[model samples]
Target chain A: MATKKPKIRTMEELASAIAVSRPTLSRFFQDPESVRPATAEKIRQGLAHVDYVPNFFATRMNRRASGLVGVIVPLLTDPFFASLLQTVELAALEMDFTVITQCSHGSAELEANAVERLLSMNTEGVVVAPLGEYGSADALRQLGRSLPIVFVDSRPAEPYTTIDFVGTDNEQSIGLITDYLCRTGAPPVYLGMPRLNSNGLERESAYRRWMAGHDLRPEVLPDDLAPQSWAFETYAYQTMDALFGQGLYVDATILCANDRLAMGALQAAHRHGLFNSRPGARTRVRIAGHDDHPLSRFMTPALTTVAQDIDTIGMTAMSLLASRIRSGKPGEETVERTFPAALKIRESA
Target chain B: MATKKPKIRTMEELASAIAVSRPTLSRFFQDPESVRPATAEKIRQGLAHVDYVPNFFATRMNRRASGLVGVIVPLLTDPFFASLLQTVELAALEMDFTVITQCSHGSAELEANAVERLLSMNTEGVVVAPLGEYGSADALRQLGRSLPIVFVDSRPAEPYTTIDFVGTDNEQSIGLITDYLCRTGAPPVYLGMPRLNSNGLERESAYRRWMAGHDLRPEVLPDDLAPQSWAFETYAYQTMDALFGQGLYVDATILCANDRLAMGALQAAHRHGLFNSRPGARTRVRIAGHDDHPLSRFMTPALTTVAQDIDTIGMTAMSLLASRIRSGKPGEETVERTFPAALKIRESA
Candidate 1:
């Protein structure tokens, strides 16, 4: 019969068994350098006799800062966020930092929990694309005070005193697309989500401002009529289907807030026998969107949209955070960086 | 003017100033529980006078394991992986575990590097969707020896002893779709990636077996002619274009390896003026795919494909990992779990 080994429950027990003081054993766990060489060797031998695994969370609390960087995105299911995360991870790796990503699933409570967890782990810094209007502003503000944080893609509903931000020039991008639509065809009606985040609000505002300047009426799907989910494609599809049934936008062009919405709306149009064609082909409907997502080009009649400089945004945010981390300064002035978005002309528009 | 304060450089200096032994000061830094309450208070007060951020990565070396659970996927930009990641993350959260995801970017070197980093972090466990034949099998096998690892989606080319796996039943799924396609139209030709991973190879083999059972010729894109990149959509699009240019399969229906590839092929067909309709309709061709990706339903004419039970796969992988972790037995017999796939008949086929 095999003999059973004894289970050591705590570090204190193991320390006592080795005839070393508990503090000396604890010191060995923190860093072998902190303890004398002979004492460290004894602790190592003591560990060999027992199955003891230290509580990592509790260990983290005693440490100052980890090399880990936390990245929080609103939704991992969104290709935009997915692409952005890939870029951020690659950049972090280049700078010798390992990134850990968390998805909020578009909930304030979950976002708060993610932040709390990151803080508890003693993360050195964070790059977050916040949940915006739906996020817990208080938790984020509190976190900003303790660690180096850089906000990307969308800013928070409530501003932080010294947090840096990196994002696309949504106003310019939306206005440029709107102007092109007007010049080539009928002014496009805006179709988008509710005020979910700063990006959504800014894009809507930019569309309204551009339409007003061009003397064109701005039409949008009312809040009550829009779908109430983070699944933008499904929402756009359902919204467009309902609109088509009601004979709304019979001869109008539509500009979606993002490429996902456009994909869904385009599918709805195709299902309704509205084949997309070139600008002068007298197609039933003309559709365009922002954010030239990866699949946008693969869509039938290819989607015409604006492409944000995702690489630049990710690199800039990382560079800014790296400076802050190196300087060990959390009291630096806020820096705002914006990358330009370019128009991608394809078959749809 | 603010007075210049003396900088306490090392832990030894702070220990002397606080009237505590250096080992006791280190003990407080490891875990407060290791030192007496009185000694911990003195160390805390001493820390107030200095800006000392301990090197956390070095400290982690002394600990046995971290609270972190690693999730490795082939690519983050793929919506299929994104959705799977979301499901796994939610499940992990339900079990009170936080997940950190890493993308391998479809490179074996990067995959190896990711596994190495996760091991260095002393992660509790890992759920990985490997890059099939392209992954670093040795690295994964080495990792399996130290931790509880559950392979999800695509398995590694070289199997390790006692490694658990959870995935979709690709053989049954391919046969079901192929039978449906054959009954509805002409025998579909196999369009897919090179044998990059088990999923691709298994799918291709299944397609061949199904075709052979029906006394039909097996048709696949020659290996030398296939695209080399992991961008499946681009590969499909380019392959279809090149094939069309060569005047191959003028009236034949295409059975794509996955939805992403099908989307690309469909786009290529559309560009080539081959609008897909019902099998008997007067359209240029029909196309069907597997793995009903999220965007497949929103495609023009929607996609005809098979839906893998992603939720079940994710949930099962997590559950299996949780059990292995609780048991603390890395030498357990290997377990393989496969979930059935359902055929979703849409307009394309």
Candidate 2:
């Protein structure tokens, strides 16, 4: 917004400047015929006196075909998001849609700003993986009133009941891994990720439920390092190092919430000389994770994890949003589309 | 874009329908006052009959403050690019600019399409990491003529001399690592990455220069596995596996083009049972690389590499773009801004 400041700063001021009601002016912008001809004309005349980009808003409001969709993610570094965005982009391209992308980088304030930015661009719909725990519900609810939005990855906590969600069924996936670990070896000791969103809690709860079902005690590790941090690798590495200071796990089986944390746990094991032996060295630690990361197989001891099917999640999110966009309304009933995660057997566990 | 199809399809047909020339219609849309009042009125009347979204273009053309800058990169899978995008995004936010992002996914056609998408959004400026060898020069040149464009990570060859570039000084950084390898151990056998961009060739040349300076013959490996693929790890893994099949390298030291490649090479070594020994085991193969990737430090024995200041490159690119945007003109003289890379010695080498 490098343009010179308008003498009238806000829409309230502009509405007052023209002696027209704010709602009426807003209505005129949305569609000139929605307001009386005299009111619409007054709003137009007022617009002529301002340097603000109301005309841009006016143009967006008048269009029936914006040919654009916005995609907002917490961060691109998460391999999973990177893959999701790529899949969505290809799907968008096929539908003759241009994707405008913004990363919130896990900041709630920035996430809100990203929504505002997308609104200003007049995106027809949005597919966003919101900052689950830290998000502002009001901002998102406000957006839901005007445009169709499809949530990917972790759906935020309640009060977001109206938004469609497409993600891994954490219950089934985490349970699958937990079952596999128990069947093949000692029951797993749960290693958690930062409570960035619902996934952290959802995944851990699944592990605890499985343990309880099996009549075994769940060893859920307390976060001793960077709690609530997205730096999964560093967090896991440091937390694992501290755990080693106490002693090795009695079960010698670890199940991390995600593959990234597993990667770090392995690195820490290597640092503490636990990885010096072959993975099958009987007493060596067996670690597994979830969300088969792109590099999981390439890890020192290839990671054993659950695959979340990002392609399905991404394509499904687009399909759901497109239907809403085509209908030109937010759906009457929001739906949750969950996919199962498959167990990927690798060297680590 | 989902609106009822208009009776008139193409703009050319619309121009003929309205009994006006195409260029005149284009000029009118760019600025209605640029054409005769009657002609503009006729064009507006014709538009009322169509479902096309011409007003969106008109609004962008009429504005001095789009408040938007675009970023197009080849892919987000690369840790370096991921870090770079994050930096630029934060910098863009600081400037009160919203960023529109697109990924080329290493396709020249897609890169061109990304440019078109940004143009239609009427971005004030752009920071792009182009598909170096395969990029569409004409598309980028056209964009450069209209708005300031800053290149990051890699600069394309001829016909792109006009765009400002910010990247690592590969010669200094590559040479620094080469010297360290030579002084501490045997001269390194060069392992090249896919020549996806300029950095690929530049780093290799720098390595060659350092070897020549020391009066040693450089052994650049043949790209037997993946010549131009972006899947760096798999490529290096397969290539190194083939090399290992031919017996171990005589030098016993490997200098990879980037840390990702080194990672793959390391995995291949482990697969071949060469990585099972301790680093101090004199006969153990030594591996080093460039571009200290985010995960380089956590590699089994850790990776020794060079660091490109992504924070500086990203911030500098934004500053250059801001100045050009402020001047309302692409600078008359294009300049290359390169930062020297620092050596990050870890256990691998």
TM-score of chain A for the candidates in order shown: 0.81, 0.80
Please report the candidate that would top DockQ against the real structure: 1
Q: Which candidate comes out best when scored by lDDT?
A: 2
lDDT tens readout by residue for model 1, A225-249: 4544788888888888888778777
Clashes in model 1: which pairs?
none
What would the DockQ be for model 2? 0.16
Q: Which stretches of candidate 1 lie over 4 Å from their true place?
A: A1-65, A223-228, A276-283, B1-65, B133-135, B223-225, B276-283
Tell me how many residue pairs clash in candidate 1: 0
User: What's the TM-score of every candidate structure?
Assistant: 0.83, 0.82
**What are the per-residue Cα lDDT tens digits for candidate 2 across B1-349?**
2565465535578788788998898788666899999889988888886744343334454466677899989997777888888899899989988788888888888888788767656689999887875457767766786679999889765446566999999989988998998889888998998878888888888888888988999988764534778898998898888888787672289999888889889998887778675555667789998888888887877899999899999999998998889988795788789999888999989
On the 0 to 100 scale, the lDDT of residue B84 in model 2 is 89
